[model samples]
Target: MSRPMEKTEILHPSLQEVHQSVDTTRPGSLWKKIFAFFGPAYLVSVGYMDPGNWATDLAGGSQYGYTLLWVLLMSNLMAVLLQTLSARLGIVRGRDLAQANREMYPSALNFILYLLAEVAIAACDLAEVLGMAIGLQLLFQIPLLTGVLITALDTLLILFLQRWKIRRLELFIISLISIIGISLFIELWMARPHPIEIASGFIPHLPDEAALYIAVGIIGATVMPHNLYLHSALVQTRKIHRDEAGIRRALKLNFLDSFIALNLAFLVNAALLVLAAAVFFHSGHTEVAEIQDAYHLLEPLLGNHLAPILFGIALIASGQSSTITGTMAGQIVMEGYLQLRINPMLRRFITRMLAIIPAVILISIAGEHAVGQLLILSQVILSMQLSFAIIPLIYFVSDRQTMGKFALSTPIKMLAWLVAIVLIYLNVRMVVEQISGYIIQSDSIIGKISAIAGGAGFMILLLITWLYPIRRKSLVQKGYHLHKPQTPTPVMPIHPYHKIALALDFSEKDHAILAHAFAQGNPNTEYLLIHVVESVSARILGKQSFDQESQQDQQQLAAYVRMFEEKNLKAKGVLAYHRRGKEIARIVNEEQADLLIMGGHGHRGMKDLIYGETVNYVRHHVHIPVLIV
Candidate 1:
């Protein structure tokens, strides 16, 4: 005879295969993957031309002209390299940037890095919301505070998009980018910039102190922190294995898509600079703050009022296109770092609300110039926060154990090291510059000393961040355990709806005993009423022709029998049961029944006799807490 299969053996696949097969091919051609890679990168370009970017670009143009356009080339290249690394790490390792960071490093390091990254992204988001509100103010002439509040409504808009195909949604966003792209391209065409000057801008030479600062600001504006987070998480959308081939594919395509999108961004940014340089560079335009300035500057060359309208369309497109990527990135960061899941709408609202607060408050009191300063400073915040993400990506990609053969090569490691060093230097420079500026602005010697002391203290905080994780982990691993106070367990009150099950047969005395037991005992525990119908003897009865009709109707009669059993219980009960065609122990084993209650009849007959074999079978079969009544 053949052996029966065990239950566990029937349910699961081999462990080795589960991770190997992730559903990569759905309902589409190869073009779908190409389009998807295009989606998130382009969505991120919103940050590139945000009202904040507008201010920085405006300042660079008004104060320095096309001198800083060279920065976009380098920054976009950096963005492509880093974003691709992030995406490849996520796709190859099956981990988000934060989770990967947490696993690759000591626990304390993970938590600290996670916290700092969250704060930095949140700060960047605040600036984006502020810029959106400012854009609304420029376009619609709405109150800044009201515009900020209205920006929260974008959450609802994003949530509705979730029901559509992600591809279609991406295409819609791409279309918007194209609209903005073409409009900007047209603006660039109409501007008729001096070809030699634009070429010189690309040749990379800073003319003065003002030019150097604007160049730094452009680099900061072009490469954003959230794009790195967004790209890494987005790469996971494509199905990729941990093998070198999959990593190579993901790395190649992601970098290609990022390069293309960012290059487009670079062209648009350069056009903005060239347009500004041509129209306002030496035209005695000392301070130009409005969309009207770019338009007014262009009217002389375009000989049409259409330029302002096209500029408005482009600005709106820039704001509208980026909203989804920001929302999606917010979702990834929240879920990745905290393991918190929320609908997209609520997450976007939280980010936008935080961002809008400072933008509105400052813009209302201080004007667009202050808003411009906020944008520049926000880039500084972005660059600083980027290290939170970059450190983790570098650490994990460089790890041979996790990545195996796909681990970073020496050349890649060197590149990452360079990126890390540059980030640290930039952060330090920003801090030093801010401190020196504050000292120069102050009147008293005490204030200068305080500014210097604060800057030193801030640097210490940054150092502590990197060291705290290692120290905390070391102390804990050394067995110097820190204990937290335990809270007392709560007393749970008995519930009236509580119940208990008492198995039964057609015995009046058994029903009476159960009624009395319930009346005396607490009602907190729930009863699971059950009936077992034996069907192994069904064919035996029919073949014997003693109870042929009754045997045929056994399944139908089981429900009525249960109802009769419930009727006899007197008190209320919940119904539950198992059936068997052979040994009663089979059902007991399957249900692991808490108790077995069968009648010991007040009758004398061979059929009514108690069976020790049945009781012994149940006792041997189950190991749970059991009762026999």
Candidate 2:
């Protein structure tokens, strides 16, 4: 079995920090069970109602009145269905959309998809940066540019939140969601919109060419591509049982979570549009398109200062909440597509910078009024990228081999494709309309050439993505690379381990654990000893802890390393912080250990309730064989 240890290098999971990080196995009531699975969707839900959304809904309501309310409704329905499919993909396949796309699509196609996803994220961050800056301007009267600078500091906040439990972060987002919902409710109540008109707004109708532009923005803002990618990875944070029955149960509960969470987002969005319709459109302030304009007019129209104050508070909350999830989605996409790993702080900082630089440039040149148009343009870019992500998702979930019995039924497959086609059609039509209008108005040869070239390039890329999967099947059938079929490689016999890791607790049994670890290793073999400091100081301060217990643990580990060196065998000692079993797994992977040997306390039954079973966790998290002595 040791012979195969070198072959057992498991690929690191998507969102490695939080993959199966939540414990839903706690014996509890039905309600308690429901709460356990409630987090991921709440996290994804915030993205659906982020600052980008506020811009579109505000523009729609102020300009088109409640006519675009149906757009929001339609977009919400689309969002709910697509998000449910994303969750189902994650729970059933254990692969996020990016991961699935990489595995299923060709390499060149994967790179393009990755780029498109990044563009979507950057566009989203643009809206978020502007939204938050606008919020600060409205609330505390900060200069817009200064507030934009201030938004960059949230990278630090993301790094801070990441150090805590996943559920804690989810709760933080939920609190923000509540603030936004309450603020919207108050705005709706104070405006006292005619109930009949609000109802009529739900009936679908686009009033003009301008209305069509805002309608696309609303749809783009609502059913985001990044959110779809984000949702799949977030659902994997839950510890779902892997059997058919267990997976089905997880799917059912997560669907409930998505339904409730997304509907709340819908209400926030609907209220934004409604508030604008009632307060601005009817009041003859129809050009109140920008958030700042709406903020200023809120007090005069609603007859209260509190209306704008609540608006600002909600806007800040939305921007802050959306950015956190946006960074996480960035991580998922980068790791899933390119297999690149970087520090979480660095990743967040880089992503924020991408968004910040664009906003800074645009604001410096055109001043503040142009921010609203930029926000809407960002959503349209996101809308254009939707099919690349969606088509792959449909291909994966519909495949019988990938999803097994849980694969979507034929009718559902058609519906999913229809959604994808509609998104693609809207995106193409909008881009063509913009280009055609631009070419007609501009005499600049370079500008027209650039516009047409860009449009054609994107269309070509989309066509390739749509056809690549089918083309792959056809290539193999045509025996394009036909040589005779190769025979399968035969398995070799097991050999003794060449490299071993010992998980030591510094208890007296550590020596016994060492004896077991050395048994399978030859004189040429190397050894690594791993221990985690779970003391209060070590837990709180991590590697910087200089407390007595940490010092002693460090010294003890050094002593163990010296003892092994005396035997003339290669060896080293490593200190890990926080959780014991988790650290042990990380160390084992880092050291490239062929096997892990750890001593069990044999604390079964009630004793297990006190100290926990770490050995099981280590084995499950690591690919190497674990020998519990």
Candidate 3:
């Protein structure tokens, strides 16, 4: 028996570029050190105060007064603790929660987790898109469906912003947070909430079953599952030394960042509840549960003209900020869990479309009231998926093998487990209560039976996950391996002429192709690097001369040739201007090459058809052996 090889390389996504934009050497002032760790938590905090949360807070405040405020406070404290652990996982282990899960779990279990994560992200995005739509409708008198369509354009905005410095994106989100905070401050001031009552609201009391349901909603809305995944990955955006002292400093600064940003979120949530309690509850409108209800009622009850406008502004800001982070989380989860990568723009479009489709159908069929219910239901779905993320996080961070010297201490481990148990219990209770309501309200016998069966299966799944072993050594022993018998090696046949023509596109994949080609090349083999510069709009109009393009290509080709020459390989550079596939075939034949080597994108089906298969075209045209990487 033999052990599998260990994976040593760190994975770097586009967000990793943030590491280059900031100095993390700890050579600055105390404030500067704190500033470097500030961005990720703000991104995480937006999930806490997004429009999904606004519905729960507004509903809780208006219906139950300040009674559910204690839930809001407790959930925020839990968020701070969990987010700190998430950041520690990234800083210490150099992997996000999704990547960590992929590394730890079996293929079947990893796929299950990936599906759950996608569902959770789609649910979160649904709330955000709907919130943005409602905000547009409230502010600009647009239809709900029209606003939903309009919200899709933010994908372009994200694409545009990401082209600039990452720090600028952070500042933009921070500015939106400031707008939300200011808006809430103005609304709270106008409402004149009772200070003593607001203070008493933190005393931990649930009035009835209805309060408990809303309390669960508050927890779901606060400790978002995607935020946990996002934070772990976001912490990796800082360039930190891979040493104990560096990890310690980064962890401490990240804790402060999470604490401050989450507390700000806490204030915003509390202010929303407090404003509702003062204006709606006091005015005998105890059932103002939806956000639109709160927005419409604010102007008449508070006698302030800017109240509704500010509320709508805050909603839009929250939705837009949350949409950005949600899209990033979708990318992180897909790449991390499944090891599948797609263009960020396409990924965003797909996730946004998944959310938008459901929202549009429901809004069209059931109207705006259904949208409000769907928002709350989305948070509930997030709550159900929270345990899948949290349990793995606690198990990994507490394992000495995974965390090394940065592992959680005994006391913190106990506290984290306690938090896990409490959350699990709350989730189960919510699920049971929801199922019981469905079973009782349904008229069809089949529907009742189905609800009961589904609830039982869900609970069983949770039980299995809870009891799953977390010890690393045992898991490694049970892991599957592909074993093959040893066989004798065969000798290779050499060709009389050895000349290789390498087509260069200067893409990242080109490096791999070059490495493969060089590994197979011999000292006697001659290599010619060819690059073609196709004229822009040549297909639409006529071919135009591109002198500067030819010069740049020649420079790039010469640089590559020098690289090969330095490695003691015989090489030459050729620059040409024509259609890429046709010119590459021409170069291979004119150079009298024995083989053609080129890099390819490896796309399939419609993508190959849409992008056009240059490698396929060149292969059909060339007479020699064509190796496509």
Residue-level lDDT of model 1, residues 137-195, one tens digit each, is 65678776786778777766675676555556667877877887798778777777778
> What do the candidate models score in CA lDDT, each in turn?
0.60, 0.84, 0.83
Q: Between candidates 1 and 3, which one is better according to lDDT?
A: 3
Instruction: Give TM per candidate.
Output: 0.67, 0.75, 0.78
Poorest stretch of ten by lDDT in candidate 2: 1-10
Runs in model 2 with CA error above 4 Å?
A: 1-10, 474-629
- Write one digit per residue (lDDT tens) for candidate 2, span 3-87: 1011012246668788788867678898988789998999999988888888888889999888888888888888888999999
lDDT string for model 3 (232-351, tens) is: 988877877666677788899899899999999999999999999999888899999898899899999989889999999999999999999998899889878776777777889999
| Candidate order, lDDT descending | 2, 3, 1
Arranged by TM-score, best first = 3, 2, 1
Candidate 2 has an lDDT of 0.84
